[model samples]
Target: MLIKPVQDMLLHNADHYLIPADIVAVVQADNNLYHAFLVLTKIKYSKIPVLDNDGHFEGLISLPLITEQMLGFDHLNTEILMHMHVSDVMETHVKTVQAVSDVEATLHLMINDPFVPVVDADGIFQGIITRREFMKSFNFLTHEIGKQYDMIEKDFSSSEKTN
Candidate 1:
């Protein structure tokens, strides 16, 4: 199928796909690893956004990072790492997308992340667009296309009978 129509649909309905920041759980860079870990565990999120003191987006902290850091300490008690700051373990180089970004671009960005953080032009953290949300939209589109195709087939059959 042609991509233009899908692109148009995404562009027109872009706002519906966004998850606003208020609902997203974020961790502060200065927060201790224990606090960040608690947030991740309580939310059941594999990764969470890291925000600086000014509430600007900093990076992402994931379980893998915590695990990697814990592994480095060897015999040191895991609790020791908890006292460390999330800034020490969180990935600083993060990828973010503007709220106005097209679905195609967002999808591409999501290939490397569970969710892509949305930001305003001024770099203010907004919400995130999760892969789950994108799949839901895709499924709806395909279902609608199937219904349209069925209608066309029915119309074609009725015309043939009249002829």
Candidate 2:
């Protein structure tokens, strides 16, 4: 459940390097959602990042958002794209998980969060935790340490049952 071990796992993965940093970039407030979409189109297979003016974690400008907007665009004039700012559409009340947070907490955060923004203690943006990363981490955790998941899951279920 430690972050150091999880970070090490991330680093140890052979395909981790293939995962580009820009795959989880934070977008600035000045950036338009349209521009964001354009950037996404350029890196369609990668994760999207959204950041604040000070390079803090804002929220994710995800593929789902783009797909939703694109699908709904038929109802609006095409020019509506040009006037759309990220602030106008981005989730302002973003849920952030600290970089030092334990892996278990991060998993819970990711489970409930629309998109979990990973940040440092100062709230500066680090990277993001996608469902993919969660899955990958889970694979690593369970595979490397058998029965760890069973114990963790049992504890979690007990807590829920008690609550």
Top lDDT hit: 1
C-alpha positional error of residue 119 in candidate 2 after TM-score superposition, expressed in Å = 1.2
Candidate 1, lDDT over the whole model:
0.78
Q: Judge candidate 2 against the unseen true structure and give its global Cα lDDT, from 0 to 1.
A: 0.59
Deviating ranges (above 4 Å) for candidate 1: 72-76, 146-163
| Candidate 2 segments whose C-alpha is farther than 4 A from its true place | 1-23, 45-47, 63-76, 112-115, 146-163
Per residue, candidate 2 scores C-alpha lDDT tens digits across 101-127 of 345565677676634566777777766
Instruction: State the C-alpha lDDT per candidate.
Output: 0.78, 0.59
Which stretch of 10 consecutive residues in model 1 shows the poorest summed lDDT? 145-154
Steric collisions counted per model:
0, 4
lDDT of 1 by residue, 1-163 (tens): 3366566545545667788888899998999887887888899988999988776888999977776666653463578566799999898888788864567778888787778888777777888898888777777776665553433345555557765
On a 0 to 1 TM-score scale, where does candidate 2 land against the true structure?
Answer: 0.61
Which pairs clash in the backbone of model 1? none
Score residue 115 of candidate 1 by CA lDDT. 88
